[model samples]
Target: MASVTLTLLPGPDLLFVITQSVSQGKRDGIAVSLGLCSGLIVHTFAAAVGISALLYHSAVAFQLLKYAGAAYLLYLAWMSLKETGRSGLSATEPKRSFFSLYKRGILMNVLNPKVSIFFLAFLPQFISPAVGKIPLQMITLGGLFFVQALLIFSLVSVFSGMAGEKLLKKSMGSKSISYVKAAVYALLGVRLALLEK
Candidate 1:
């Protein structure tokens, strides 16, 4: 139940997947979600082994990662604006390969230190000394969480993709959607920038 709640909550990861679904299509959104969840696997492993603790405690590492995530968001915003110009009057937003979207999702999630911190802090709650091997328990729990996230994200992608398809059918609507996508990306970047390390 907690996993479902957390996955459904409004957060950067959810927002990004929604934007991708609305701007591109369902496939890209699912691909990106898979990539993002893959990053969570890394975080799970790191948390299990205590590497996430090292990141959590080190100021320099946290700040560097925070800035990098912010910069990437800004870059994505810029890319959206550029696509907006080129997509003028087009029926589709733009074309980007599935692999590219997947890679971007992985990089974006991996660079966000908050995720690592969340795993470090949250996963321990479900673990008990009675579980015997702690690392194995963490991995199992994290995988369960990821599965829930995948389902929620997939639902979001489907609905958003339907909306995007309908909106992009008209020339004016396509332009409007493009501008909205750019605005959302810019806002996400600003939000990331304002986060304190």
Candidate 2:
């Protein structure tokens, strides 16, 4: 329940997925979601292995990662803004490969140091020394979290895609979509830039 709630909460991941669905298509959104969840695998392992602890304790490492994430998001925002200058038709836009979207999602999620710290803090509450093995238990919990997150993100993609298609048919131009996407990315970038350890 907690995992589902967390997944459903408004965050960079959810915003990115929604924007992709609204602007591109459902499949692209799902590809991004998959990539984001793949990043969770890394975070889960890092938490279980105490690497997250190291990051948390190292201010320079944390700051470097945070800034990198912020910069990347800003770059994405700039790219979206640049798209606004193109022909105002969606049909003229070049299709992005699934791999590109997936890679973007992975980079977006992986660059956020807070996620690893979150996993480091959140995963241990359910753990027990009485368990067969601590790391195994953490992995199990992480897997559950990953599955739930993927389902929720995919659902968001589908619904958003449907709405976006309708909106496009109703005369929402590609330029408008580009503006919205740019706004989302910019806001996410600013939020990430202001994030603290």
Candidate 3:
């Protein structure tokens, strides 16, 4: 449907990032993905306010951030590929703080080039400039999108919890799945970085 596509404007690949990461419940992985999704909320609001204007008018600024993000993503990907999807902490729980995880989610979305661009591009479709209060509309729409994202991403969290918990119980092999999850995040980051304008 149109609505589904719009919320997921970046397409199936992005979903794949979430899906693959959620395939198991690495708490850190789920935390990171939620952090990313939460970051989208901030991007949505910032775009709704003025980031979209800057992106539309300032070519240099956009490119600078784009490349920076790309480099980071590639670094993540390279790190992932280096181990061929094998990491020692795959089954170990790191000392992660909940507040830090939430903060990380916010940053992931904020630093994410694709999300910044998508909010700049997508939410305007249903807006009516002629009706009145454009800022209000952007806010309303952005809020709606956040709610949609929250609903979906939270479900992802639950699944991540369930799946990871279930798999972890079965065998030691579950640890390798953690590496694949990181690889997915890195790849998703790289792909997002490569997008044009």
- Provide the lowest-lDDT 10-residue window in model 1: 85-94
lDDT tens per residue, model 1, 33-129: 9888888898999999999999989988888988898899888888777776554334553566788888998988998888999999999999997
Error (Å) of candidate 3 at residue 113 is 2.6
- What is the per-residue lDDT of model 3 for residues 1-197, given as tens digits with 9 covering 90 to 100? 45455655655334543543444344544566566666766777777788766775777777776777656555654554454333333544344466665564555556555667777777787789898777678778777766666566666666656665566464554545556655666666666667676
Global lDDT scores for all candidate models = 0.84, 0.90, 0.60
> How good is model 2 by TM-score?
0.95
Tell me which of candidates 1 and 3 scores higher on lDDT: 1
lDDT, residue 115, candidate 2: 98
- lDDT digits (tens) for residues 1-197 of candidate 2: 98998999999999999998887778888999999998999899999999999999999999999999999999999999998765333677788889999999999999999999999999999999886799999999999999999999999999988877766664546678889999999999999889998
Top lDDT hit: 2
Best-performing candidate as measured by TM-score: 2
TM-scores of the models, in the given order? 0.93, 0.95, 0.74
Candidates sorted by lDDT, descending order? 2, 1, 3
As for candidate 2, its clashing pairs are none
Q: What is the lDDT of residue 96 in candidate 1?
A: 69
